[model samples]
Target: MDFGEYDNRKNRKVESGVPDVCKSEPCMMGIDEAGRGPVLGPMVYGTCYCPIAKSSLLKTIGFADSKTLTEEQRDNLFVKLDAEKANMGWLINILSPNYISNSMLKRNKYNLNSLSHDTAIGLISRVLELGINLTEVYVDTVGDFNSYQAKLKSIFPNIDIVVSKKADSIYPIVSAASICAKVARDKAIKNWKFIEGDLFHQFDYGSGYPGDPKTKQFLSENIDPIFGFPQFVRFGWSTASSILDTKALPVKWSSKKAIENSIKTPVISNFFGVQKQETVKEKSHKFFSERCLKSVKNLF
Candidate 1:
């Protein structure tokens, strides 16, 4: 059999890339991941398997891509689907920022994408362990959909993988998987806060997405003084590495009297020039000013 030619399609299997069992029976599983790009959270994988007969129920349950749903909507649907489904499983693979940083250094690879694919494979393995017969699996594409499918297939030789650019949006089950993954990941992150108290003081850090200013600030504030970057930061990243070479100079502040005196005193442009006549003030004013200036300067 030429496995290269089999393909997964909506109602009908294509001549190429179609699984032999899918021709006789539809055994489908939807796969997705959450927290792939987050620098401070765990990467989660979700897989939901249902018989072909129940596929329509997934749509009725309001399952779509997790991205398309608001947090509240996703939370609602996640609870509903969790109670409704026959067999649903999830794997929350915690990837700390420190672990990610080390992985980048040792493997010379981007931790986000690496964790995404790893989590996807992990869900697939769990599905197999549950003894569910999986013929074709649909997954939302992260990077190179085909490459991700190939990687999954390499690990599970007989598994037929269907990877689409937005499979989660198209397939209800994939969307459900996305919701489960996201909800699980969010809960895990919240729980982590209690466990790692004060470690991540800036709560506004918004899940470490690149667009979040709080996340950037958190990273900036945590840099190692000697190494110039935090041990938990991905130093290989340009943003983290740049912090190492940059230094913030200390800012000096002067007392009010010192500032006033400095402005009043004529700055000598050339020491060799004849001394300019000094302006004299009232005896009382001069004495009080002198005493104040002396006291302020001594305080510093």
Candidate 2:
């Protein structure tokens, strides 16, 4: 409840409810983020001060990878965590899709890893304002582990940072931070849906992950008119770009030149000394066929 006194130095890092190598060190803070990949919603970063003595309590709250837990499970865990902890502080940055798009356009690149690291650093800096004698911090790596640590160090020259891949899975405090971040993001998304009204109603895009069929359907249907084919959807990302490009234009071929140019005319290839030419159809047929082939290949 008293966010003012929260300090990273009073919390120690533990691995899966057990104190291992990090036990000898003093308490530290754990940081993580959520909703980085989603085309919708804001990017949220969370940091928590977990003491070495309360590692068991964190485990009992179902602390694990946020990706592995359901929304209900995360919400439940977040509630329990809020009730048990007093040294936890959260900082959320609500970046709209439009703002993200503009940044990508201005930068001429989409750097999600860098963006995530920056957000995490912002939250960590806010936590440091309380002057909790925080010497060290742990974060789930968004880019090169060492680079992320260095970036955090540059921002907060005094704080020692450890950035590891899958740190949430390996560190109990990091996992707790993950749950907090996820729950906060999910709540923000739900609230956004309520505020956006009918726009979210037509598109019941379940979480914004690529694995979600509803999300893909929503993107396919609305990306062109509503979201527009811009940097907001991560133009560098194949999925986002593919959806935007495919949906932006109409399926119908307007002219003979368009159809002819679109056709995939295969060149002759020698297979075991035998050469053959394949006549490939144009437009949707060829595109759908190639996509299907690629999908089939990935499955095996």
Candidate 3:
């Protein structure tokens, strides 16, 4: 699309010399994500791509592991990226907490790992569609590295793909991706607009981690009776689940058996009008337990 028009903030993307970046020169792209562990805010997947020869320029610009850099340092690097738009390009996908929670809560259960893998694959495919000649891709991962790498290889057979635990520290390009992703996630949390009320009015949920006392307190106190917390909270997380199950009203989720057996099917004896009384064996609690176990085992 309009790569030049893409902005960095507010979940914007930008690129330059589209055709040249697309297929005219061999390029390498780095993939990294932020906010995966957070219970609040959106998870951001970011990818940065450049011509293979200029990858070293990433180090020259002071791009390194995002975690090691201070917030100001990350901002400065992004500023440099903006200045050198011709050589570097990046894009990001912001995944809302509501979307993540809903995915996991679905009947078929699409977990976070699956969502992450799909998002990364989508980013790579999007770059290729824009006509960028992506020859190699390096990705940072918290899950199974080999499986994720294999999955990317299966999808993009021609391109080389490498998935590592801390590739963000090892690869400059991935480090760049990490910075972009982190900045995007931080902005999302800071700029969060709550549907219930003003975000600033709500207690500061520090970093949205379970270990953060502020975050825990915010989650425990801010839970809504009807809607749960605002859109920024991942309600399906274990932290939220513990509070909900014990403190909030009980909620019964439907299952396959519950849906199919809304009304119990009448036995043949009922149709025949037979008056078979409950036997002494059937009256015993153990007999009911045995019958329930049989039914459960049948389903499996």
| lDDT by residue for model 3 (1-300), tens | 122332222244433344354367899999999889888777888888889988778989888888888888888887786566677788878776766787888779798899999989989988988888899999998589998999899999999999998999999999989988887776666666554557535687787888899999998888867545666678789998888777777777778778678757778777688667776753435323321223333332
- How many clashes does the backbone of model 2 have? 3
Tens digit of per-residue lDDT, candidate 1, span 26-103: 467887877666555555666666666657778787787788778888899877766653434333344445455555
lDDT of 1 at 60: 81
User: Tens digit of lDDT per residue, candidate 2, span 159-258?
Assistant: 7778899999988788888887777666655554322235645557767776678767766765545335322233434566677666665455357677
Off by over 4 Å in 2: 1-27, 51-56, 108-110, 194-199, 223-238, 246-300
In model 1, which regions exceed 4 Å deviation? Answer: 1-26, 85-87, 107-114, 194-199, 224-236, 245-300
lDDT of 3 at 39: 83
Clashes of each: 9, 3, 3
| Residue 44, model 1, lDDT | 63
37: Cα error in model 1, Å? 2.3
lDDT of all the models against the reference? Answer: 0.61, 0.60, 0.77
Ten contiguous residues with the weakest lDDT in model 3: 1-10
Evaluated at residue 212, the lDDT of candidate 3 is 92
Candidates in descending lDDT order = 3, 1, 2
